[model samples]
Target: MALQVQIGKTELKVNPIGLGTNAVGGHNLFPILDEQAGRQLVQTGLANGINFLDTAFIYGPKHSEEIIGEVVKENGNRSDVVIATKAAHKMVGNEIVMDNSPAFLKESADEALQRLQTDYIDLFYIHFPDKDTPKYEAVGALQRLKEEGKIRAIGVSNFSIEQLREANIDGYVDVIQGEYNLLNRDAEIELFPYVMEHQISFIPYFPLASGVLTGKYDKNTNLAEKRGKFFQKELFEKNLEKVERIRKIANEKDIDIAHVVLAWYLTRDAIDVVIPGAKRADQVLNNLKTLDVQLTVDEIQEIDQIF
Candidate 1:
C-alpha cells in the first residue's frame, strides 16, 4: 500500500518508503549497474508501491535521470507517480560551480524535464545550499517554476533550519529534504519543527542512515561505497551501540530492523516522506511493508528512549 502526505500546497499520496536510486544510478564507488537493470529497478519499485523516486543531475552526472526517463516513458504511467530531481552544482570549465541564480535554476529544471521525458516535474529541489548565493534568489527561481508550471513544488536537501526559514519567507517552501533518521535527531530539534509550523513537507534523505541504522552492517563488515560518507571507522563503532538497541526492540516486535527504523520516522509530527535508496526488488518490497507496520504511541515513546 502507498502512503499519502500533504506536500505543502500540493497534496500528494506517495509511498512512505521511497526508493532512492543512488546505487542504481552508479552514484557510488561500486560497479555501475546496467542501464536496463536500472530502468527495471524503477519499474519494479513502482510495481511494489514505491511512488517517490529521488534523483539528482549529479547522480552519475545525469545518467540516472536518463535511465528513469526511459523507464517512466516505457511504463506510460507518468502522471500517476511523482518524479523529484535536484540541480545546483553545475560543472563549469571542469570546475564545480554553484549556480542558484534564476537563469541557471530555470535552465537546470528544463534540462531535467527533457531528461525525465516529463513536461512538468512533481517536485524539485535545490540540491545543497551555496553559501555565496542569496537564498531568496533561489526561492524566487522556484516560485517562477511553480508559476510557469515547470514544477509542482519546491524543496531543498542538506539544508539547515535557518536556510529553510529564509527560503520560505517569500512563499511556502513545499518540501524540505534533510538528513533525518532514528540515529540523526538534529532535524527534530529545529528543521523538522519549522517545517511542521509552516506546513511544509519534510523529506528525510538518508532515512536509513546510509544503511547503518538498517542493521545490514556491523562492526566487522563494510557498507556500500555509496555510503562512504557515513562509514567512518569511528562513526561505525559509535553506531554499534545504537544498532544493538534498535535490534533488540525489533526482535521483540518480530519486525525487520529497517522497518523498525522507518516506523520511528513515520511517527514524527511533520515527516511527509522518507527517501531511502534501494538497489533490488526485494528491498523495495520490504520498504512498502513499512506503511502497514504501525507503531503505537507507547511503542513510539519506547523507541524514543533508545535515540
Candidate 2:
C-alpha cells in the first residue's frame, strides 16, 4: 500500500512520494527536452499511484505547469492529484525578476490557474522572496486568495528562518519547500523546529543533493558545467566521501543507495513529503522504490554522523 501523508494542517492528503516536474517542461533548464517524454513521466506517476507534484512558474518560465495541466486533463478530475506550484519571478525583457507585491501575486495566481487548467490550486507558493516586499504582506495576499477559493493552501519556498517566522505569524502557511538533504541539514538548526511547532509541512527539494546522494559519482567524476556550486572540487570530494559511507550501508542492506538516502529523510521530524525530480518514467519508479526501504534508528544516526 502507498503511504498517505497530510500537508500540515490542510485536509489534503497525498502519497509521500511526490514528483518534482522541473525536468518535464523545463526546456530552458535542460538540454534536448522532449515533450512526449515529459507527458509520459507524469502519466507514469499517476498510473503508479504518485499523486503529489511540485512545480514552479520559473521552471521553463511556464512550460512545466503547462505539461502538468495537460497530464491532469488526460488522467482525470483536478482533484485526482495534488498540484503545488510557485510564482515569484516574471520575465522582464531578457531578465527574470522576483516580485512579491500583492498585485503581482494575485496576477500570478490567476495565470497559474489558467495554465494549470484548475479552478483552485492544491497548494500555491511564493517561489522566492524579493528584498523590498514585506514577507507577511506577501503571505497575506495568498491568504486572501485562499479565502476567495483561488488556492487551497499557502506555501513559502526558499525563505530564511526569519522570513518564514514573519510569513507564518498567523499560522497561515501550510507548507515550506527548501533545499535539504543528507548533505545539507542546515534546516535542523531553526526552520525545522518552527515548522514542527506550527504543524507546517516541510517538503524538501533537491533531496538527493543534485544526484550526489544517489552514489553515481566519485572522486574522478566530472560534474557538468551547469552543476554550479556542486562543481566545487572541495564540496564534491566531501560529498563523495559521505556517499561512500552510505553506499557501504546500502550494500549491507541489499538496497540501492538512493533508496536508503530518501527513506532516511522520512525518519526526520516535520518532513511530510519529498519532491525528487524525474525526467523519465523509470526514474519515477525508481524514486517510488524508496517506499520499500526501511531505516533503523542506529542506521539513521550513522548516516547523520557521516555527514
Candidate 3:
C-alpha cells in the first residue's frame, strides 16, 4: 500500500497520487465518455490502494460525483477512501453561475453528500470564487459545516493569492487546488510560499498539462485545436522540446515520462497531492506507478532547469 499523507491540517490522509474524476463521467467537459469505463476507473483505483478521489459538481454538472458515489457504495469501502469534492456552480434558469453564499454552499454540501451517498464528506472545497461574495465569508460557511460534522476539511480552488489570503483569514481553509505543473509555474511565484507558511496542502490540477507533459507529443504531432492557447504552435513546439529532455531522464531511469513528471511535483514544497485524470481503468493503474518513482536531487534539479 502507498503511504498516505495528511491533507493540510486535517486528519484526513490520502495517497499522494489521487484519481481525478473529471474524465470519468464528465460528459460536458469531454465530447465523449463511457460511463462503464468511468465506474471501472474508480473501482480500479480503490481496489489498488488509491483512497483519494477528487471530483466537482460542475463535472458533467453532477455526473462525476454520482458515478463516484455509485462505485464507492458498491465497493463497500466508503470508510477507507478520502473523497474530496467541490461546489460553486449554481443554475439560474438555463445559465450557470458561481455561488459562495453560506446558504448555497451548505445546500451544495447536502446535495453532494446525497450524490456521494455518504453521511459526511472528507473534504469539501469551494470550487471557485464568486465576484459578489467575500472570500472569507465563503470559507466561513464551510467552517460551519465542519462544526456540524457534515465535512471534515475546508478547501478553496481557483482563487487568486489575494482571494486565498482573504479566504484563509479565519484559518479555516485547509487546502487549495489550482492549475500547476512543470509547464506552468505561476503558482510557485506566490501561492507556494503562502501555502507552505500557512501549513496548507496544495493539490495541483492538470499535473500532466492535459497529457502534454506525458512525453507523447513531438514536433510532428498535431495539437493545434487540442488545448486552446496552451497548444498554440510556437509554445507547443517549445514545450515538446522540454518534454524530450524529460524523456531522456525517464529512459535512463526505466520509467514512464508521465510518472517522472508526477513524481517531480511530489518533491515540490506545499504540494502534497497530485490528481492526474484517467479515462480508463488501465490509465488509472498506470498513474499509480508514480509511487515507485524516486528522483535524486540532481535529477530533480536537472528537470527543473529543463522546464
Candidate 4:
C-alpha cells in the first residue's frame, strides 16, 4: 500500500513526504530563482506522487504562491494535491511586520486564495505570532476561516510550547510545522510530548539542516556561499562530526546519507510528515528516494546517540 498519513484529526490525508517551496519563486529568499524552474519543481514532485506542497506568503513575499498557482492551473489536478500555505508576515512601507489580527489574517487568506487561483486551501497556518496578539485569538481567526470552508485544516508554525498550548486551547489546530532535524532535537524535549498527547500531526521543516546532515561537507569544507545560523565555524565543525558518524552508518547500509537522515525522522514519535525544500527537479527526485531507505531499530538508536 502507498504510504498515507491523516493530518492531525482532519480528513486531509497526505503522502508522508512533502515539498517545501521556499526556493520556488522565492526570489527574495534566494538569488537566481527561475520562475519556469520553480514551476517544474512542483510538477516533478507531483509526478512522483508527492501530494503535499508547503508554502508561505512571506516566501518571495507572495511569489511562491503565485508560481504554485500557475502549476496547479496548468496541471488541472487541484483535487489530487494537498496545498498548505501560511500568512501573518507582511511588508508595510519598507519594513516587514507580523500581524495576527482577525482582519489582517482573513484578508491574507482571501488574497492567498485569489493568488493560488483556488476556491479553498487544503491547509492554512499562522506563519508567526506577533508579540501583541493573544495566541488563541490568532488561532480563532483561522478557526473562523475554517468554518467558512476557505481552509480545510488549520496549522501553526514557529510557535513556542506555551504559544501552542494557547493556540490549541480548544484543540482546533490540525498540524504544527517547526524546525526539527537530526542536528537539532530540541523539539523532542517539550513540543513532541504535547503534540503526541493531543494527537496533532508534526511536520518538520529543514529536515536536512540546510544540507549539513547530507554528508557532503566536513569541518574543513568552506560554505562561504551559504548564509544561516548553522554556518558558524564552531557549530559547523560539531555538526560535521555528527554528519561523519551518520555517514559511516549510511555507508554500511549502502544508502544515500540524505535519504537515511530523512527516513530516520519517521522513526521518531508523532512525526507525521517532513517537508524539505528543493531548488531543482533532480533534488525533488532525490528527496523522493528517501522513501526507499529504511533503518533498523538498532540503527535508529545508534543514530540518535550520535547526535
The order by descending lDDT is: 3, 2, 4, 1
Off by over 4 Å in 3: none
Model 1, 1-307: lDDT tens digits are 4556655557666766777887667654246566566677789987767777888888878878888888878887887788889998888788988778778889999999999999998889999888777777898889889889989888887778788878888865888888777777788887867787788888787787767888877777745443565687787778777788878778877888888888788777787667777777667777777776777777788779867
Give one clash count per candidate, in the order shown: 1, 0, 0, 0
lDDT of each: 0.79, 0.89, 0.92, 0.88
Cα distance off (Å), candidate 1, residue 300: 1.2
After TM-score superposition, the amount by which residue 46's alpha carbon in candidate 3 deviates from its true location, in angstroms, is 0.4
Output the better candidate (1/3) by TM-score. 3
Best model per lDDT: 3
Segments of candidate 4 deviating more than 4 angstroms: none
lDDT of model 3, residue 229: 57
In TM-score terms, which candidate is top?
3
Global CA lDDT of candidate 4, please? Answer: 0.88
lDDT value for candidate 1?
0.79
Better of 1 and 3 by lDDT: 3
Cα lDDT tens digits, model 2, 1-307, are 4779888899889998899999988988997888788899899999998999888898887999988988998897678799999999978999988999999999999999999998899999999989999898999999999999999999999999999998988879999999898878899999999999999999898888888889888877866653666658888898888899898889988888999999999888899788888888999999998998878889999998888
